[model samples]
Target chain A: MANARVIVITSGKGGVGKTTTTANIGMALAALDQRVALVDADIGLRNLDLALGLENRIVYDIVDVVEGRAEVRKALIKDKRNQNLAFLPAAQTRDKSAVSPEQMIKVLDDIKAEGYNFILIDCPAGIEQGFKNATAGADEAIVVTNPEMSSVRDADRIIGLLESQDLRGAKLIVNRIRMKMVEQGEMLGVEDVQEILGTGVLLLGVVPDDETIITSTNSGEPASMSDTSRAGQAYRNIARRLLGEDVPFLQLAEEKQGGIFAKIKKLFGG
Target chain B: MLADLIERIFGKPEKTGSVAKDRLRVVLASDRSKIPPEVMDKIRIELIQVLSKYLELDDTALNVSMERDEDSIALVVNTPVHRVREVKVS
Candidate 1:
């Protein structure tokens, strides 16, 4: 517990895959034998529970833990698939004003006392009271962004705010990247995004835009648990990197072109 | 198929990626400095007024802008000074 890490996953723009990143990375870290807790800090608009397919198991939410209505252990829902993974859902009935930044830190401290190796908070979109609450207890931060113009600009804003809070060295995760578009010079590449975001933020991982992610999310199973999903593999690599393992970035463009032969072989059941 | 073939042979006319990067560079420089265009104009006018008392400055050719590097953002001001005014002894 002394070395436990509390990280907040956030994006200034909505629908940039902040919740998905938190769910996949949490599951992947659990798969790597680390005790992980996924906390949904999006109070009014909760989705982390649904993403992890544990929505039905939520008897109490984070608000309950903060208000002393329920203990931290009572509010946490253990993932059915992974014993080491647990989730704390946000209260849907309440809004962002329901919890303050100080209360958020108290809740996280209680969760930390449970002996989790990693606590990942899924921060709500925007830079409001919700964002402050999500980041109040975090020692580190991860900024998720798409390669599009608007997303990149919002990410730059979030990075500035994080530095102002003394949360330096926040990692960057460029998600939903279309390699084909990047190859055609239609979409921004990883290097372009890094240059725009400046040198303060480090690259954590790059997740390709994969269709399997849609199917996996629909069924409450994150793509990170799938053996064939490229996005899933990327999430796994991110987990390894978090554990201090040196792993190479995935060669997404080459694999996409060379996968023709592999596709043909799969059709023949080879 | 034909379009793909043509693109492969001649390449795209313009890369939107570079355009987006260029636009973001200008936008973020202003966004991080929290200075809008009107504020920049005000700062320029104030600089010209203060400097004109001590020296003759070419206000029309004066320029004020923000330059961003890897770790810091700088307010870069470029002004043309014609001559310095001598102060009378009181």
Candidate 2:
């Protein structure tokens, strides 16, 4: 029916790519001509604007709209690249309680009226009130976490929180993965994450660890806009999966040599 | 089934996978219960006190264990039986 779907992307712990994931996904959606809005729910540590390259234009924010200091449309900053994408920045001065959960719901509903395919909430780190405020209005949740121990631990807690809500569906998107490390038995693979979470991941995409991401991020350009970037490809895959497409995971390494495992199987055939 | 599940859940953790799953599971248990292992020990002792009034039991008989089931914990008391005695009633 073209009604907007609200997805709060969160990991209970910090620095696991919540804002970056939200930005890339918003960019991907907008590229598909889907009207998308990314709401930065991280009030205190707000950086979605910097990541999206709209930091200087933030004259109004979510707190402004919530507290009646500004109109919702006034605070909405259209993306420099896509007319279909807009960002509602979090207020830097005020804290999380500056806006209540009900206020967030009202904002989402107002934005939906202007016609959008999706509304993404860039939830702050931790299981605190900010997280609560971010999630309270969403129909579904996309739990973002790294394959690392601390990230997964926080993800588990976030998963439990999602289960407590009206969960349209909760999907897992693992970020900053190196497939070579996974193949070499140096890193955590997708299987390990799924088992501990004890659920089916609706969408699984691996953003490879590339220096390009940090460089582009620092320069205020999303990696998703660059076709050659590996991290962009991963986010693109996730966007396709979100739209209900079946795409295989990225094979980052050249493993076509039919290695020792294949030889062992052939030898057992006798 | 067990082997398939083992491979599925643990996912052949080279290093990161194992650490991630282990850390997540441990944290999740506490998150759901809102009670750490430290507090659970005290709760176990209190539970044993009530059980002692009904019957004479050893430590083995009074084992108190908990399992995480989604959002709640399933608590069980495993009681060992050495003798079944009936007191005389006039």
Q: Which number leads on DockQ? A: 1
**Model 1: residues >4 Å from true position, as ranges?**
A253-270, B1-12, B35-90
Per-residue lDDT of candidate 1, residues A86-184 (tens digit): 999999999999899999988888888999999999999999989999999999999999999999999999998899889999999999998888877
In model 1, what is the error at residue A205, expressed in angstroms? 0.3
lDDT by residue for model 2 over A32-139, one digit each (tens)?
788999999999779999889999988999988888888888889988788999999998998989889999999888888778889999999988888899998898
TM-score of each: 0.81, 0.77
What is the DockQ score of candidate 1, to 2 decimals? 0.68
